[model samples]
Target: MIAYLIGNIKDKYEDFVILETNGIGYEIFIPFPFDENYIKIYIFEHIKEDCYDLYGFLTFKDKEIFKKLISINGVGPRTACQMIKTYGIDQLINYIILEDTKSLSQIIGIGPKISKRIVLELKDIFLKKYSQNIYSTYKYDAVLALMALGYSKLDSQNSVNNIFLPNDTTEDIIKKALQILAQKV
Candidate 1:
């Protein structure tokens, strides 16, 4: 398993990115757009009988969550990518924990039955994993604060990542995030 990739992006398409490392260009499917020309990202390498694919995520947790999503009987990599792209990890976890089928069903290929299945199957796992993590709350709050300030979730996340400090309060995080977001515009 190729667990990580550190490289300069050769190209970015609608659903995938080509990262060049050591004369090799690896195409990695991504759930959201990333701006940096150079990236160091966690990777999930999926191999099947017919194809080999690599999926990248900015955070290790997101990659782990993606693996879990693909472990479900009916969910595949494409569906999992769509899920992350549509709802993001925080919102997806929130919907699952809250059993918000209506919201979950909004993703393409996810109907009421699949939504309920996802919620029922993954709620315990997500809550058990994330409930006690203080960072999760901070991430959720920062995302909401950024969204309230008119930044999309993808932009907010890119801005807020790697900026959190242990001593920083939620307000401090939001302020720092806003500053970073402003610079990108």
Candidate 2:
């Protein structure tokens, strides 16, 4: 079982990332997909109970905070991931610090009871730890980035929003988008 990987970020996505490690590319996904990408990322692997999964974070401390997240009794990996994905590690940690169980409960699958329990059990651990980096890391975001190119308005934004990072400048956006379009032929 691979505990973690360090490599050149060959590709990055909202749900998955490909790292080129030791001449091999590894495919990894966070427990839950973030709604946005604040920065490119790094990840920790958790393989157990018949599952091969990844939890991504901008820093090693973020990964540690995620570990604290899943430890809550009912949280599990998916729920923990949902919490992070819904509000990000920073926001969620902020909620816990501020005693905002209501916001945490709003996450899908996190009922009132579970929300309270999450706050009760583990809030203190993550209170001030995740402040360093919690937002996304992608440049210009994928959506605005596509529109800034020439992918029409709706089609480009939606497609870029849905796919992974196209980490490049405006010129690169045009070149890559055209390359992607050409592949359809």
Candidate 3:
């Protein structure tokens, strides 16, 4: 299996990129856009009797998340890509942890049933395998508060995570995050 590719981006399309490595060009599907011409993409190769596809992620964590998503019975690589593209990693983790099927269903290809299944199936795995700090009630509450104040979920989660410290209350985290966000503007 091809673990990863390090090369220059020969071309880019809506959902895939052509990377040239060692004089060979490989078409790899991506979940999000890449601005950098040179990159090292962790790869996931899907092979069946007649189908072969390459899915690439910027980080190992992203590759692992993609693998986890595709492990579900009905979720395929494309659906997993769509999920990541729509919600991103942190927000998707938050949605799953909160069991918010409605938000998950808002993705283009995901419906209510699949959203519920995604939550039901991945919640425990995420709780067990991923960072326990992000699953804390205080952090979750802080992220929600930031979102309520009109911040994007990804930005809110990132800010909160960056400012969080042990023994700090949700209010403290939110206040610090707001200050950090203010400076960024």
**TM of each candidate vs. truth:** 0.72, 0.57, 0.75
Residue lDDT tens for model 3, 43-110? 99999899999999999999999998888777899999998988788777878876889998887778
For model 1, residues 91-167, the per-residue Cα lDDT tens digits are: 77777776789998888888888888888888899878875444566776898989998899898887777688766
Residue clash pairs of candidate 3: none
Candidate scoring better on TM-score of 2 and 3: 3
Residue 116, candidate 1: C-alpha displacement in angstroms:
1.1
Error of 3 at 85 (Å): 0.8
TM-score of model 3 vs. true structure: 0.75
lDDT of candidate 2 over 1-185, digit per residue (tens): 44456667667777667767779877766644444423445666778899877666666666777788777777776677667777776667767765688898887788888888877876656544543321222323444666655556666544443443434444454455556655654
Give lDDT: candidate 3, residue 88.
84
Q: What is each predicted model's overall lDDT from 0 to 1?
A: 0.86, 0.63, 0.88
Best by lDDT: 3
Q: Count the backbone clashes (under 3 Å) in each candidate.
A: 0, 7, 0
What global local distance difference test value does model 3 have?
Answer: 0.88
